[model samples]
Target chain A: MAYSIPTRQSTADIIFAQLRKEIMSLDLLPGTKLSEAEVAAKFGVSRQPVREALNLLSSESLVEIQPQKATRVGRFSMRRIEAARFARRAIEIEVLKNASENWSDVYAPSFARCLDAQRRAVAEQDTHSFQTLDEEFHALMADVAKAPFAFQQIKSHKSYIDRICALSLKDAAEMAVLVRDHEALLTHLAAQDATGAEAALRIHLSRIEKTIAAVHHANAEYFND
Target chain B: MAYSIPTRQSTADIIFAQLRKEIMSLDLLPGTKLSEAEVAAKFGVSRQPVREALNLLSSESLVEIQPQKATRVGRFSMRRIEAARFARRAIEIEVLKNASENWSDVYAPSFARCLDAQRRAVAEQDTHSFQTLDEEFHALMADVAKAPFAFQQIKSHKSYIDRICALSLKDAAEMAVLVRDHEALLTHLAAQDATGAEAALRIHLSRIEKTIAAVHHANAEYFND
Candidate 1:
């Protein structure tokens, strides 16, 4: 069920999407000050739409709105990142379990195609493409499980950890390990082994524990709490 | 791990919160046209804040914004609601399992107190308070499981079903059944029975299936899909 209605984006909507992508991809680092006037000038829109965009970001906790002061990209919090991982693990585990039980031969080709794309991404050392495919991998599991909204919720939680995950994905070795994990998960699903797939997913998601620690150790200033 | 930072609410934030509550409570029924000019006049603010509020609501799918046409409260979609329930169940079942395993005598009083409040709400015929306490019941389970973010995610999904749930809660008999389900769930948690508690939760959340069908039958015009 596609819940998205095809409505045209307002100026504010476009600005919000662009800023959200930048923030999530770490093109805009945490604690970076955002001036409404500057953003308006850059986007060639009035300050009203910029302010609206900032309000939207503030609601998502992507930015902090300090009245009478400046708005800054929200800093990372270890607590939030861990909490998000915990929540994502719960839903994705369920998704994997269902996908394993409901596995069919039809999905094997796409699963294998995605794996090949991941290998290519790692070989090319294209971190951005790897990250996008990584998301698509998990989303594919949700599709196999026929639980589209599970992936939507996972995406919502993913934002909290994207900065750290992006930093982790920069390492080619880490990308290789993730691809192997995805391969293992797909193998389990293809075999209709629910327990094996669930276990494989747990190991896959736990890679973040080390990544979070390494990312935070290297960039402590970007985080709060 | 309180992720919420206490920033002062802007005019738009206040209006957003108020309108969100109205929409979720079904006070501002589905398909009700919302006018920026009138809402601005009513709130004694410029249209910018009202538009911002509406935009925020639109982001949550609580409102549908048609650029040239009128913006109206979003009609309920059975597909989205079911998807929301599926996502909510996945996280919540895990929460209940953890709460059962981590059950301690210390939290029993609070759990019992919440159940008592639910009974009182039903007896007093206070559907609104009952709903609020029902949320608190789940939040308490999250605390017991030490998974606060899980409850936050559940609440996010809950908003997708709140309008229908609110309608269902209007019946005293239905409210009584829900209270009893809560009681059974609490009993299993108190006993530290993970399997039992998980089963109880599955039964508890499944009540929405019947409620959705009945609510949609009676209020067919309020739904889009």
Candidate 2:
């Protein structure tokens, strides 16, 4: 008890979070079966907490739990991925446009830090860590726009995108290209070039969408028809 | 089996659909405890169907489930509603702007129908039906944009917003102003007035924010603090 999993977080919270981290990091690949009994035994709890955790994850579209069926990591949906990408691209470009128009000097350092983390993630060849930082980088853009929650829709969409990326094991060069896109976006934002930022960000997301679809089709077995 | 419900749509579907309708209409108010035993009895089924129904609702953020405690209709949250509205506005306006750029003569009829329904809703003093039509009206914008999923996100967020509105009960006059705004938006979209439509839509969402906040304060008990 000297070193607990931090104070006051319920077993459900702990279970939900641990499972989410695994899902996001691709430690739990799409379509991976989530056995309630196994999860309960591993977490030193009963089936109820595991069920609740799975329910919460299901809300995030991270898991699929069916009545009288085994719980599993969620299936891939090309339509949904495409749909999420469209929404993310549309909204992100808008946010970039806003930040480009209203770039306060305050967000500059965090933006730089985000870029650097991606760089390090690449150098270390850590796709897992790189993906997390990639999310943070997008979040930093929302911060620059002073509309942090504006990215919530995109964030949800991004996880779906992440699932595809995880299954594909995208090339490091593509990751480098993404970093470059972020770099270009930062430059345009720094210069307050609203139209230019929008254009650049649009191109970036379009490329991601193309690559994502290719990845999905390449592993059609992993996807839901 | 004189008449059959599709297996894809089962008892769980019936219970979920019925409960969702009640919640949306505010016939089942926020904080109202949902006893599976009672709900099952009313539906002339066993508790298993009701339990699955509640789980489905819980995943959709329409019901609250507490471990070892009773489940209930979730309370409205000003924070969640405002957050939802922000997202709806952000996404819907972008789709509206897109629609203006590519005027779809096909969806014009749908848009007209939404307006016609709104008029009926007001005349009949059916706020609940009005809200459903309001959703269709916005979904029409996405149809016009060829970005149907954007409407999907808006629809997901609308449930949260509806819970707040059920508390506020904004007057019929308020509904009229929104209808007028929709008409203006429709006019602008028809004319392909991107800038004007975006401006009007922004103002429309801003008014919703103010009115919804006023209602939140006036009836604090209806929401989850």
Candidate 3:
């Protein structure tokens, strides 16, 4: 067994992480005003840390700060979501292309474990863990491609798409579909079929369009574009 | 002519921009110690703004800040450079493939104009302007691909690679070679030859390897890996 040392997080970092989670989870609804004083009081800290946290969230575009006015959770924009999807697809295609060529038997066990864990998450109706497993699955693919930084870049774009995903009404169904996509993607990679892998990955990613449409229909008021 | 309004910059933003330019241009050599008080005095500002500037640079990996110890310019790492290149190449290749399919006569005149300006920059041996033109050439290709955001992402990674390019000794000759490569890429795009365009881009970006080798020989002390 290995023990990992816990890294320190600044008060601001802690505040930012909590606020970001709330925002992404849609607990802090879009257009909801964020007050530094209230956040500071809730966190039992000074307003300085709250302001810093807000600034960090603003950089992520999760919050909008109007210098003299007020800060608020960001509203969904189709334009930003589309742009994020475009960049994500481009990088993932490249990663998949490489992964198909570099597929090794060494990674099979890890893939199997992740898939089994994903299935368990689906059965247990654990959407959050399922999301984590989905990310790990894609991340494992990046490892297979030997381009971890490529996934780092993908994660940056994913936050935008995730906002829409969070608005989704059916968690278990979506998780199951996503699991199936992963299974298909892995099968294509197992066969070392670059073309088939690319096609599978595309089909996997294109599911987001249906997600966006469904979420928009269900939560039209939350979107601005 | 259309008039565009200039956006305001905060004091910290200005300091960050100037320091980034100096570091990228090799005026501030890698691993050079940076003092908050000294930089404040140099920029005719207070330590607060200087600290903010250093924080911004730290985010870009252009500087390293050790809390309560010292801050210094980031040293070159072949690992980081290669990672940046891999991401850049993947995105650029996707952009080129799109451009090859979406080529239009309307963009031809712009390409010709950019190529001519690049040539003029080479004739005058103006490395700064030449670098700007090179970015513009790439940006235009992204526009042709109808994926301007892709280029935005590429520019983020290009800063990492620019450090090495700044170290190259042959300014004019390098500019000439890059300009020629841009011309070849444009020719391939005009012919709607995706394979040729991708090949040309690979050849163009591969020049960085030679630049890296030459710079490593000249400035071995500035590198870490």
lDDT of 2 by residue, B81-139 (tens): 75676677767877987899889677788888889999989888888788788888888
Candidate 2 regions with alpha-carbon error over 4 angstroms:
A1-73, A97-102, B1-5, B8-19, B32-73, B120-129
- Which structure among the candidates has the greatest TM-score? 1
Tens digit of per-residue lDDT, candidate 3, span A67-134:
56788898887777877888788789889988999999999999999999999999999888888988
lDDT of each: 0.87, 0.81, 0.86
lDDT of 1 at B94: 82
Query: Could you give the CAPRI-style class of model 3?
Result: medium
Error of 3 at A62 (Å): 2.1
Q: After superposition, how far is residue B147 of candidate 3 from its true place, in Å?
A: 1.2
DockQ for each of the predicted structures, in order?
A: 0.64, 0.40, 0.54
User: Between the candidate structures 1 and 2, which one is better when assessed by DockQ?
Assistant: 1
lDDT of 1 at B50: 92
Candidate 3 chain B, run of 10 with poorest lDDT: B1-10
Candidate 1 CAPRI classification by DockQ: medium
Quote fnat for model 3: 0.41
Candidate numbers, best DockQ first, in rank order? 1, 3, 2
Measured by DockQ, the strongest candidate is 1
Model 3 has an lDDT value of: 0.86
Report model 2's interface C-alpha RMSD after superposition on the true interface residues.
3.1
